[model samples]
Target: MNGRNPILAEAPTEPMTGISLLGTTALLFEAPGETSLAVQRRIWSLAREAETWPEVREAVPGVNNLLVTWREPPRRLAAIVERLAAAWETASPLALEGRTVELPVVYGGEGGLHMADVVAHTGLSPEAIAEIHAAPVYPVYALGSHPGYCYLGGMDPRIATPRRKVPVLRIPGGAVSIGGAQTGVSASPGPSGWNTIGSTDMIFFDAARTPPALLQPGDSIRFRIAGVVR
Candidate 1:
């Protein structure tokens, strides 16, 4: 561990916080701060670069930071850390080719089991909430937590809110939700802390599908409310 926050030293240009984990075979960089659109995009870009390194096993990015796993032994751990640090110093734009996907959501009522909560927080009725969520096109920033899971941006601030105090244990596949300033679709059944406002029929991830995740980093997503479910 550097004893200093990596995000503070590395990403000083942005209001991002970071932490470093010391290990024999790998070093981890964690950026802890307010989750915003720009911060999440930058973090994903960093992960894309880290993926090119032969020694790197996988670069898993979250809302604000990255967890870089390496394939080398503990002795090479320091060297890998130095490489990652230097990359941040001269970070360049990622060349990842992304695609766009349209997701249909059935917001409010039965489709959105927690639409009432959104109404409570924003004082927007279920109908208005659906309009707001579908108003803007969102950009996929990262895939996280679980496979085919996406972190998105471009949500209307009116609907932005904190995650649920108690997370749902298992949301059905294709659940659409908002957390912080972003909105996303659940590719598989999993626990989520975000506010569930609706669901989509679009399959985000499928093991049987040739390219599992329906959306990738940099893809655009627009939601279409299926209809009110009685």
Candidate 2:
């Protein structure tokens, strides 16, 4: 949303050559360009492929990057890089038949502390904002801000607003918020720069669960307006 990282910003104009090493233990595969379904699908595909490698301990996807990490750094980093490049070359856009999770939200009340600000920025009524937001079946781009938190793509640009210049100390879990061109659901209580527009009851994470994360990469989300909070 803040634009691609400097390393990737200038490269989208050219062909996606391959993955590059972030350091000794991680590989960063740059996305073709801005966050999109095609790019995210490719990233998720590469992540799944990297998991097949014996050295990879985790493969985390970002908005426009794929980061693969190893428990123990490989001795021949070049070999790993080459292997990733090969995988990228043959990788196809992942066919993710992911389940759709519908989240019921109560918009514009005490929970949505920044609702007024959002209304002011977008010049839309609270109801209009909620309608625009809930209309799309957003793709889960990546999970990163906090455990089980989702970075969702496909927000209506009409409702898009920049993050708060000064971040709030803490927002409750299940907070539906927006930052820049992206919208997301918070999974835990934490500091955030995004503006909260609503709150949902959907549980995002539970340590007792086997996978812990409720939403996986490639999944889709639909928000429903339960009612207004106030």
Candidate 3:
């Protein structure tokens, strides 16, 4: 195991280009190679290109994957799949220079209900954990889980912690959390399997506003240490 900490996120069991059916409504394309920003950019590139296809209703990006939804499964599915593989070969990283928003976080006390759990797992002090978590300018990889929520990338690996065994019934909005190799702040929470270590007061979604989500893929979040709980 190279004597590395076992808390690290596991490697992908499936590799190379893979296509699967998410029911019959959509086809999911999982990109091969390491899960890095470059790969993510390639997924972004694929999404942009795939969206223009007459068959595609929408091309949604995920962490190292793309979901292309359609009104109905195309009749020439095999040909479409072949074309998708061909498209992936030529797809290149699309640099999306987006807005950067800094969020002030409170890294313990009530906000961090699971702070002790993370401390137990990672063997890092809360302060150290906060510092490591705050170190990176995380990119909004994609949005999922709930409305206006974002899936972020670029967390430091030292503090990697597995998702909770059992999800909490509900976590407060603005919860800054970690689940395995990634982390993000919850915009509006319901249930989450991630470890909550901190929180912010940012209102990420407002239905009354146009383009309700505060951040999109390619946007950035720099977490500022507003306060740390001892």
Candidate 4:
């Protein structure tokens, strides 16, 4: 919610900053807390600048932070931060541009093994739940936790349910799941606490393919129920 946008008009009376050990380099940024939004905005602003800088190798945006990875042309964190701050001061945010994709899923019964649990928690029928989930197009957030993992946002509050009590160890690939207010597609067989409401046949990441991950940040995804749960 806070990464690219800052809620406060000005920096708080006391601002915090720090460094994180990532790989062989250190990432500097404002510490996480109530001011996370402000920090994230600064990070985005800096990342936008770093994008133009030759020293920075990669600038990855996250839920509330921007990761600047550098290589070869060595530079200090302070100098990078200064450059990023200047960039944030001058550059206007680019328009939100991404593709919209519709995904077909099978919900309920066996397909949505967690439907009963969801109904018990939200007091909604399986049909109602399906309708609510399929109502809106979810925005792709950050892709992580697993390769090709599509981190999505924007779900009907009615269908926003908690994760499973215990995660299944080996959820087959293409598993469509919901947790809290987000939905995602599992790109590989792995364990997760998210509620598995459906499954997709789409291959998210393939080694043999030119590009691996099917979903990217800022992309929009829609859900369409194609079959019954059983």
Clashing pairs in 3: none
Order of candidate numbers by lDDT, starting with the best: 3, 2, 1, 4
Which stretches of candidate 1 lie above 4 Å from their native place?
1-17, 31-41, 95-97
Q: TM-score of the candidate numbered 4?
A: 0.77
lDDT score of model 4?
A: 0.68
Across residues 65-139, which tens digit of lDDT does each residue of candidate 1 receive?
Answer: 678876754344445566666676566545445666667778876657877888889998888888889888777
Most TM-score-accurate candidate: 3
The C-alpha local distance difference test score for the whole of candidate 3 amounts to: 0.87
Superior by TM-score: candidate 1 or candidate 2 = 2
In candidate 4, the residue pairs with backbone N, CA or C atoms under 3 Å apart (3 or more residues apart, or in different chains) clash, namely 108-229
Which of candidates 3 and 4 reaches a greater TM-score?
3
Q: What is the C-alpha lDDT of each candidate?
A: 0.73, 0.84, 0.87, 0.68
Error of 1 at 131 (Å): 1.1
Per-model TM-score, in order, reads 0.80, 0.87, 0.90, 0.77
A best-first ranking of the candidates according to their TM-score comes to: 3, 2, 1, 4
Greater lDDT among 1 and 3 belongs to 3
